[model samples]
Target: MKKVLIVFVFSIFMILIFTVDFPIKGDSLYGKYVNTNYQNTICCVEAPHEPDTLILFNDGKFESKFYGKGWFEIYNGISPRIQLHYTSFGKAALFNTYFSNKFFEKTKIILNADMNHTYTKID
Candidate 1:
């Protein structure tokens, strides 16, 4: 009975430590890019009016979106592919890039593009 209690307590402690939020702080945009282990290749053109957000995974996958709604996702593929959706003047374009994350380092934005964006993560 004592051994069981100790094991249960240790398991609970391990869970708490592993599940704790380990937020890395810095300029929310630049810091987030670094925190995701993306190295220095990440760049943003035509800064958004709001903060950019990042969702990172241990498997070398990530998603980032600007507050104005411009976004991209990186997947594990032979070639890095990205889909971008932006709207300007009430017109929206969904652009697809057949590039590999290993080769591309910057996220580019063209002016007069729609800005509202959303991202979803899949396991």
Candidate 2:
């Protein structure tokens, strides 16, 4: 009986951890993300633009334009890489041209700095 109770408690704890909100920090993008490492960069772009604008990271790799209605398609060429529609909304500036994609979804990303120049993301 004791073991059964302990298992139930542990399961509940795990579920809570998974359901908790984990917000991505906006300031974290101030530096460049090469492959996956953050390096210093001078480029960043904001929103209101359609979801098809290609993002060139300071590292050399390119992030394809986000598709899906209201969703920001952030293609990092990594896991959790699937389309992430903004489950929540926040303030972000938009620049450059916009492209059309049907998978739009509302999403938000905190910027470490302003988007002023072009950046590259190398692998």
Candidate 3:
């Protein structure tokens, strides 16, 4: 009886630790951006813009869309550069144009290189 109970408890613990969903992605990345800045030939300081940089954590991955471009969701995986502390849109402008970021010691910002969107955490 003791061995059986131990096994049962162990199984449950494993399930909770490994099978459970951690909101790490959602908590760490999901939210709306409200300011923006464009850095081309001349770098402009922070500017006002819409929350075009939208990031959501669903299922078990991250999905970022710009200006309601759901079709680009299919390409979110175009590269891992999409999710980093600091990034450049590069030639893959389709994938990089939006959701840029500069990771600070404690905070990070995602920008839209093309759309020029910014995110501000409301929650």
Best by lDDT: 3
Superposed on all Cα atoms, the candidates' RMSDs to the truth, in angstroms, are 15.0, 15.6, 12.0
Q: Give every collision pair in model 3.
A: 33-118, 33-119, 33-120, 34-118, 97-113, 98-112, 99-111, 100-111
Which tens-of-lDDT digit does each residue in 1-123 have in candidate 1?
999999999999887655432322222212133112222333443333334454444443444554224544443244334445555457774555432111122322221223312221121
> If the candidates were sorted by their TM-score against the true structure, best first, what order would they fall in?
3, 1, 2
Expressed as tens digits, the lDDT of each residue in 1-123 for candidate 2 is: 999999999999887655433332343322322221123352432332332333433343334434212323333321112132332245442322321111221122322324422222221
lDDT for model 3 = 0.39
C-alpha lDDT score of every prediction, in listed order? 0.38, 0.33, 0.39
Two-way TM-score contest, 2 vs 3, winner:
3
The regions of model 2 sitting more than 4 angstroms off are 23-49, 52-123
What pairs collide in candidate 1?
69-116, 69-117, 80-99, 80-100, 86-114, 87-114, 88-114
C-alpha TM-score for every candidate? 0.27, 0.26, 0.30
Cα displacement (angstroms), candidate 1, residue 45, comes to 12
Better of 1 and 2 by TM-score: 1
Estimate the TM-score for candidate 2.
0.26
Q: Candidate 1: give its CA RMSD in angstroms.
A: 15.0
User: Where does model 1 exceed 4 Å of error?
Assistant: 1-67, 70-75, 98-123
